[model samples]
Target: MEEYKKRIIKAIQYIDNNLDAELSLEKVAEIAAYSPFHFHRIFRLIVGETLQNYIIRKRIEKSAFYLALRKNLSIKDIYHQFGFSNHSGFNKTFKKYYGKSPSEFRKLAPENFHKIQAKQSKNGQIDTVFDQYICNIENLLNWTNMHLKIKVTALPEMNLAAVMSLGIANVESSFNTLVDWAKTENLFPGENVKMISVYHDSFKVTPPDKVRIHACMLLDEPLKRQQGEVFPEIIEAGKFIIGSGEVTLSDFEQCWVSLFLWMKENNYSVRKAFPFEIYHTNFKEHPEGKMAVDFCIPIN
Candidate 1:
């Protein structure tokens, strides 16, 4: 990868991880080891949005998630948690995109969960998490009803060799590239190898066409040297809520939805880490083309 592209992606990872905190462009640029003007330009060029706009939209999107799913927090608490300066400013911005004030949005969340509506806003991402969450969750819920098992456990950290794939359209190609590169380095599958897709952005809050993922091969052997677009990433050891089973290609998204629903139903809280999918069986090689996959979400 170009050094600049890598830097911007690193900066975005930092930005997304700290969405609930104050994010000044100067500080973010500094973290990326670039001057503010240079960082700002590159960020917009690569991410397709101004830094300020991205931060605000991300904050709003996360706050909306909290509002809809986290019932314990008051409206004031949600706004403050997301770094809004004042109640009025948050209300104005939220209403412009969601067409509902914070409280009104909270009130409609449950109803929206049951009956999803696709309402677009100026922002490329859908204005609310409910639209995406509801769409996926309902399908999973209906198919399995109360039968799906969600397991909460602490897992050891994993090292991954990966390549960045932007947009869902390119994920398969990226995975193929990752496997080919891994083979060249003598880093191909061992007795047990996991194929993972680490999601860097939430599909509920990001536009479908622009979602980012790292197509990864779990390292059974330590890689001697790593660099470039195909690189190494560590999925930190932590408590995760895992839902695993044999699923078809279309069942993948549905299973993720079911996991989130399980989280909400059990009153579990999510943490800051990225969620990942681990594939045990390559669907392409299966007789019925089904994969034994695990959908995991980090939790507090």
Candidate 2:
């Protein structure tokens, strides 16, 4: 079982690294040290999809990212870069999966979707301007980079001082605001304090306007009652899958994907408790763009 997992992971890594290049079932199977016949069946059984479907899904997802992020690139160019044969083929497949064409997906970006739509009425002026500041991620964490290893462990109950945000698209800003508030209130007593962020709902299942999350710090003592969004809470003791790694803004979602895939492959079921991130270092201060964090998901 373990050997199968390792080989599948290797193939996934090969696929991710070479997405821009030609990726054939034979090539991937070679990377996995399996015959193409055996590899195809095992991949479908383990990953819950056929190898061809996985490749198409990945290509589309990456094209979606380029559609939003790379405004200067023509839609045709973006599809070509991802190995799609032509524009019509890409358009048909993209709309089938995302319910929109590439152009429609780009216009549907949360930051400028309405603005661009309104502008189209008068002068036909559109915001082809790509904003890096836009939190344009929608199901972007399709899969992980395959380097993350998930560990299952038991956690004791935690008392936390939390600052929460509702309906915010940029989660990092919320986290930073909470940490700033904590510092302003002299909440940090020592260097060992654990920083945590509770993800209350799945991005796919919940409306973005109704999404809720809490940024929290482990409290050694009871916090005085406050009237604002920041408050006290407890995380109950439970079993969890923990994946720790250095993450940047670009790959953070992929880390979550890794854990979710790990859970599926290992036959572990997720519990109702919210998945959370535990920060091991001050992310803002990291010299490298990456931050060290343990992605924690409670499971039965």
Candidate 3:
């Protein structure tokens, strides 16, 4: 069973690394070292969807993020980037899955979707209701299985070439697409580009599939205006208590729990805006076992 789980993860990694390339179920199954037929059964039972369906959903979600955030890229370019051969096929598949044409969905989402609507902090004060119940960090570290150091800092306003997606079922793929978009745009000239995730809700209340992930690049100049969309907006300047750590992929939940516990123990109220996970180190350059991230929590 343990070996099967490792195989499944390997299969997922392959799909993630080669989403734009031609991928077949047989090929993916072979990577898992399982017979194609048995692999299909095990994959569906373990991952809850057929491989093709999962891939399609990931592509659609990624394309939707581009449409929402980057105004310069046309629907055609976006479609082709995700491996769709033509615009017509892309449109048809997207409409079928999302129940609206891409253009229409983009136009209506800002007004209709609860997650898309931006709510400014009331009176510029952070809400501390959740902070009341937090136990001390020393106690939390001793009580919890994971421990990490945290620092508080003020972040200045910065512009970002961002791709925003709601109800992101597959974050790894969505994030990879955003990184690719950033690279294609030449947003990171000679400097290292960090990946930031802005969280709007607590993990307990939000399912992983329903989480909002914003992949962003800090920029210097204002973006050139595109024809009919909004460019990157300023991530407002504020005080944030930042948590930095390296965790195995399987231990991500514990990393988050430690951060939340720290925030609670310190009586820090969270701002009801996007919380960003800033990627300080490039994964391509780092060792496979170590992934570094800075979880930036807006505080009062």
Candidate 4:
């Protein structure tokens, strides 16, 4: 099982690095050191999707991101970047998956883009709260230069004391709640405490009501899980891209999105490990009225 996991990680890396190429089952199977037939079977068992489906999903995801970020790039160029040989095929497939054409999606306001991303249909139904949140996040991203600095480095394993929240829509409230808890437990600003948050679901893909966020503290060593309230997770050692800055509470969402888009542009593929933040200073005590935060994304 361990060997299979290692090979699968390599296979995923190969897929991401060559996403623009014509990837085939046989080629990827060879990369994983497995027969094509066996590779297909095991891949489906492990990934819950066929190899072809996974490839197409990743390509479409990248194309959608390109559509959102590279406003000047033409649809033809975007399609070709994802290895789609023809416009019609790309258009049909993209529209079918996103419930709108690429051009249409690109033209949507940031708020509508969020609604559409959350899979809300355009049947004249409006979600005011969702729209407002997305608009706020987009405004911050547009106002700031998100890609200030990025460095890829090797990271050692880390253990964290964490508090998990479900369906949290307000960052300030949730963050304050976590901080208050840490303070109550006397866990704040200890020699080993580094405040961070682990996002388990992407807002673009997961519904707002289903999102999971883990507010955590860096621990010198692992701690036993305390059932529901607090738990421990080992962040596996891997290659990671790090981005740091003085950012406001609102900047967290924008920072993460920008980091991922940067990764795509730089040809780095994200690994399966959970991405997290590393806080350098207290959120409430930053002299600049912003948190000094470092975003860490696992990658190859």
Which has the greatest lDDT?
Answer: 1
Give the per-residue lDDT digits (tens) of candidate 3, residues 131-190: 222444455566444445588899898776554444456566546655665566776444
Expressed as tens digits, the lDDT of each residue in 89-185 for candidate 2 is 9998876665567888877643332122111224443223332422223332233333455689999988887755544465666567657767787
Clash statistics: count for each candidate: 1, 0, 3, 0
Between prediction 2 and prediction 3, which has the larger TM-score? 2
**Candidate 2 global lDDT:** 0.67
Q: Which ranges in model 1 have alpha carbons more than 4 Å from their true place?
A: 20-22, 110-142, 145-149, 220-226
Candidate 2, 175: how far from true, in Å?
A: 3.4
Deviating ranges (above 4 Å) for candidate 4: 1-116, 122-147, 170-186, 189-192
TM-score of every candidate = 0.80, 0.50, 0.48, 0.54
C-alpha lDDT (0 to 100) for residue 11 of candidate 1: 78
Candidate 3 Cα errors over 4 Å, as ranges = 1-140, 143-147, 224-231
**Better model by lDDT: candidate 2 vs candidate 4:** 4
Which of the numbered candidates is closest to the native, going by highest TM-score? 1
* Model 3 per-residue lDDT at 45: 76
Instruction: Flag clash pairs in model 1.
Output: 1-229
Model 1, 1-300: lDDT tens per residue?
Answer: 368766776777788778767799999999889999998998888777899988887787677767766777889888888888799999998876666788988898744543333356566634543443434455656655543466899999898887777678889988888878877777676668688999876665556556788899888655454465577788999999998788888877667667777777778877767899998888889999888888899988
Q: Tens digits of per-residue lDDT for model 4 on 207-291?
A: 5654556777777768774433455667889999898888887777777766765665577766656788888877678666797
